[model samples]
Target: MIELSFAGWFQCRLATDPDPYDEPRGVSGYVHAYAGEPDLDRIVSFQPPPFRRTHGRDIGVAVDAVAHEGIAVPDHPLVGATVDLLDAPKFEGRNGVVADDGLEPLYPFHLQVARDDFRAARAVVPADPSFPYAELFAGGVEFGAAEIRKATGEQDLTATWAARVTALRAELADAAEPLRTAIAERLAFLTGNLGADGGGAARFFGALMRYDYVLSSEPEIDDPHGWLDATDHDEPWRASFWLGGWDADVLCGYARGTLRLPDGAGPRRSPRVPRVTDRRP
Candidate 1:
């Protein structure tokens, strides 16, 4: 599953059945793309600590050389875990719960296991009938990252990476247009009333991450490299202007992003918010 620009999601968890790689040093968790959609019957399910030894394929990626998965930009520590789908059967998700392309069910699947009798494991999201968009995104981020790594195999990470980035931005821009336009208006209002600096790009990014991106922010957050990094990786503000620049095939129907609100809150990935399964209700 490929992430849409709808939101920015990062994988932060992996749990092991044995609890072997507990608190391993220096390898602060960040998602890495897998080669193919893993065979769950054979592989372990859920997130794993770096030491939680298991096959990469079992980690829910399609096993192909060109599969390309996107990890967190500034990889953060493991705050979440990949657990047994059986343990998490209630379907608290967004990925495997797919919008069908045709008659085929594009259910978002996770590859946490591989049973010997089963040939096709549930690689996409489970068949949960009612989950919020947030759950689908959460599962798909891990799966999509693996798919991305497979899709992008060694090709130019920069250009190819940029394409996915643009796709995500477009998705987000479309989803967030209401919030974006609203924030722009809010900033304008703040600029008129308070000092212009009060609602500058800093405020924009802060609020953008909050209302538009759904990211949690802190003034004292540390970044050894600041704008220079975002310049290399992060899409520019103008990306919103160019709508159709991303390569279409690269999109895997799964995307990760933030759900920014105009409340002067913070930025967060999809899972942080409340995900109700029965949305249509």
Candidate 2:
């Protein structure tokens, strides 16, 4: 599996197809999860970080899960963490192409960590056994230039490279302290991106993230997703944190407060946020 590093800052917006009429537009509003924080001063030197534009399947899945499970969104804010997709399955369809349906593309995609995996998300059991096994979300990890330094074969673990890795780890450790705290205080963390507004377990998860984006007027969302008019401010409403070993503990701690299964078991063992090797090689 190829691993890419993503900084924990991005914008939440409606995923629109550049060609609105000709292509299938994504159904869901989504955040543009970027490789690094958008820097103004670095704009001239900034290479646009490699990013995965959602075809809207992730948001659609979240909406379906919330509706199906009868989940509820909390009145307060919730932190939304991006899952580690190192081992996620790359979705592919026949012809490796998409059909033009005016909605998001439905074929030849990869979705390593989809919103449907959250605890609050329940698969819609179809009356007909074969409903085409459709998955709304697609697209896998998009690698950036940083990956060129990845070591391989006997050339791996050069002294200088090891030093750089050690330094980067140290820097990340230092920078993550405030980011973790700020994230915890600013929003409620989720095992995955499902949100809702109900009681008990439902109170903890829902489609709230999308709710915030749709309500923000700073960058009004187009109406493909049936989003309401602006009702909230647009100042860092949500972000996607890369929870690798360097910051998993901090991120997980923030999420643990409300992230639990219906049986009252801890969420770590749950499929939404499984424990795995978080270290970078």
Candidate 3:
């Protein structure tokens, strides 16, 4: 078993075929472990493993061999964290890969930490001072414009729509305390991705409204997941917004009026909002 000790973060990526004609020959994905302090800037600079003909298959095997025992991180909050690979539901037609009688093959695999450890890891990693918006939102702005053009058959109207988005942001500012901050953070997450578009943002905003309505009407209820489910969004989308690390707890805190923004921490404009041209379609 190979043991790794580090203070940085872990990310997982699925292995892809180097040759279209040949079958996949080994374990499914790679667990990229970086060695550094948990600071984002420093951790992002660590080099990833070089590409290999086997797609890091041997690395995958080494990880899987110790899955039951789990990887140990000495002196870290996530010490004794259990490590495991994401599993597929069933084997498809990939040759040379065998699925146990009832188990699925680990195709398109990547590393996943147990829920408790994941929360702990995220908790210690200092929140990016920017909180929600980051460089990634620039890409989202372009993708959003393209999506708008596709749906409305209109010429690129991102400038006009961006104005509307700005108006929405301004309106949200007057919303009651704590809830205002919560909504801002949630909106940032919803709109901070390449897949984000105006429609999705609108829908998510509506869902947030509905969530507020539920909490107001039924003050005794403590179920954020149930309220999200009633909003009619897909499970994965809901999970991404509500269950990703501390989001659910944060939402519940807002509902219970227990969440408080630290002094000097609340919604603030990004230093610069990149122009649509700043990102390619």
For model 3, where is the 10-residue window of minimal lDDT? 237-246
Candidate with the greatest lDDT versus the true structure: 1
Tens-place lDDT digits, model 1, residues 1-281: 11112211112222112222232211232211122312112222233323221211122221111111233322221112121222232222122223211111112322221222222122222234354233232211111323333333422323433344444445445545554553343333333323334422122111111111122221111234331122211111100100011121121121222111122123422423323233332
On lDDT, the stronger of 1 and 2 is 1
RMSD of 3: 24.6
Error of 3 at 172 (Å): 72
List, in order, the clash count of every candidate structure. Answer: 85, 17, 0
Please provide TM-scores, in order, for all candidate models, with all chains considered together. 0.19, 0.17, 0.16
lDDT of 2 by residue, 1-68 (tens): 01111222121222222322212222221222123322111110001123222211111111111111
- Which prediction has more favorable lDDT, 1 or 3? 1
Among these predictions, the greatest TM-score belongs to: 1
Candidate 3 residues 130-191, lDDT tens each? 33112112121112333333322434222333543465477676867654654464345334
Residue pairs with colliding backbones in model 3 are none
Q: Point out where model 2 deviates above 4 Å.
A: 1-77, 81-92, 96-119, 126-281
Ordered list by lDDT, greatest first: 1, 3, 2
Which parts of model 1 have CA positions greater than 4 angstroms off? 1-50, 54-213, 224-281
Distance from true position, residue 81, model 1, in Å? 21
Q: All predictions: root-mean-square deviation over Cα?
A: 23.3, 23.1, 24.6
